[model samples]
Target: MLALDNIETFRGPAKILHGISMKIEEGEVVAIVGRNGAGKITTMESIIGLLRVKSGQISFRGENITRMSAHSIARRGIGFSPGDCGLFSSLSVQENLEIGRWHADPKRIDKMADGDTLEKRVYSVFPEIEGFKRRNSLKLSGGQRKMVAISRAMYLCPSLLLIDEAFEGLAPVVISRFRDALKKIKEMGITLLMAESNFSNASLVADRVYVLDRGEVLYEGKPKDAMNDPRVKKILQG
Candidate 1:
């Protein structure tokens, strides 16, 4: 459903992604895996148009999105969850979720296009959110905040979800809950593209993995294969 061809990205004067290319098929969970400073996030920003590419092309749903703005790309049904979670500390959980609803128009929603409302989809993946829906976001625990971030993204009813470091810094139990939630999202037929620095975490949810080093693709294959590859092991160790 998405393809990047030799896409190069720059951060200030420095190039961050050097001719990076990859593909994600519909309904598949794909991962961009690498250590810190490997440009995993840069690749994502390049795809979503947060950072304009210096060269090459990005195509989503068969249409070129290289020069599209982030708002425009999101309108086409792409949801992004930043690594920091990006929740509104001053707002009630319900109010935070309402912002995502702005992405959906009365004439056209995403998978929620089937008649289900945006709020229902968020609560479906994160039923726990309902319990604290009226609470100020600053009062919640780290896990709860993460759920709010995911739910807010779901409020857009997106077909593709780009989650940055979804498993990072969470308790193992919390990670397990997110894994289950992601599974449900997959079952709902939403494509997932997760950026992860930890190999083990990426393997937990990805069907296919792309190892990025420095600013380019180091390897691309199934998660199992990537785990066993000696080269990948060395790259991760260093």
Candidate 2:
């Protein structure tokens, strides 16, 4: 339900996304695969309005949001979890989530679900978060931190979730848990757009894959075909 049309964005004076375009249908999981500096995060940021698009349009559910502010975009049912996890180290996990819940617009919740609130949805996906609600975010392990970040973003009750570097630096076991959670999210009718450096891992969850190189789309096809491409595999392996 999200579409990017010939979007060209820049970071400072340097252009980073060269007419990037893609579409994400509702209830589908799409992955953008690339090495560092391949415009993966840039594309996500542009869509979420963290970075403005210099040229082209971004539409969510047929509404143009290219010039919308980041807060407005979030209020319009777009959840974003940046690569850094963006947690408040001094706050308790619950406190962090409370901020997100407070800021989120409940109307953004998808209509297809059983009308569960954002808090309920997040807790359902991550029971571990409930147990750690009182703990300081700074004290959690890496995987726990990632879980908390994802949970916090879910407080937005978004129809679409955009995650950047979601699979980096996690052990296989931890990654598996996140995978299950992501699957659960899809079942809830929320679309996912995950940016990953690991093509192999991205392939496991993605229905479609887009391989990017130096700000351009080099390949767009099924995950299997993208993985089988020597160029994509070599860049991912590096």
Candidate 3:
């Protein structure tokens, strides 16, 4: 239910996304696959309004949000889990989540799962996090940090979730765990848009894949076809 129409954005003095256009249907999992500097995070930032769009439009559920502030966009039902897993190191895991839960607009909760409380939904997606609630965020491992970040975003009760670098450096087993959580998230009716560097890992979870190179879309098709394309292989290989 999110669409980016020929949007161009800049990270700062330099432009990063060049007329990038993509769409995510309701309940769909879409992946933007690219290597470093391919504009994946730029795309996510633009969508979330962390970086303003210089040209074109960004619409969620049919309403334009191109100029909306980051918090405004978030209030409209978009949750972002940044690649760096933005968390307050001094806070306990529960405290971090409490901050998220505090900012949530209760109306954003999915009607289809109205019976489930927001806390229940978050715990369902990540049952493990429930056990680590009292632990300090700085004490957690890399994968645990990622889990906490995603869980914090889920506390927002979003209809569309934007996750950057969801599979960046985790071990295979931990990646598998996240994959299972993603499946459960989609089943719960939340749309997912992920920025991933690993094409094979992204393909396994995404229904559609977009290969971006140098801030432009080089391929937009099935993961299998993208994997076999000479140009895609060339760009991803490097």
Q: Which candidate number maximizes TM-score?
A: 3
What's the C-alpha lDDT at position 43 in model 2?
A: 96
**lDDT per residue (tens digit) for residues 98-176 in model 3:** 8777777766654535478767878888888888999999999888898889888888878899999887889988899
lDDT of 3 at 197: 92
On residues 13-81, what C-alpha lDDT tens digit does candidate 1 reach at each position?
Answer: 998888999999999999999989899999888877899999999999999999999988887888888
Candidate whose lDDT is highest: 3
Give the candidate order by descending TM-score: 3, 1, 2
- Root mean square deviation (Cα) for candidate 3: 1.3
TM-score of 2: 0.94
| Model 1 TM-score, all chains together | 0.95
Better by TM-score, candidate 3 or 1: 3
lDDT of each: 0.88, 0.88, 0.89
| Model 2 residue 121 CA deviation in Å | 1.5
Whole-model lDDT, candidate 1?
A: 0.88
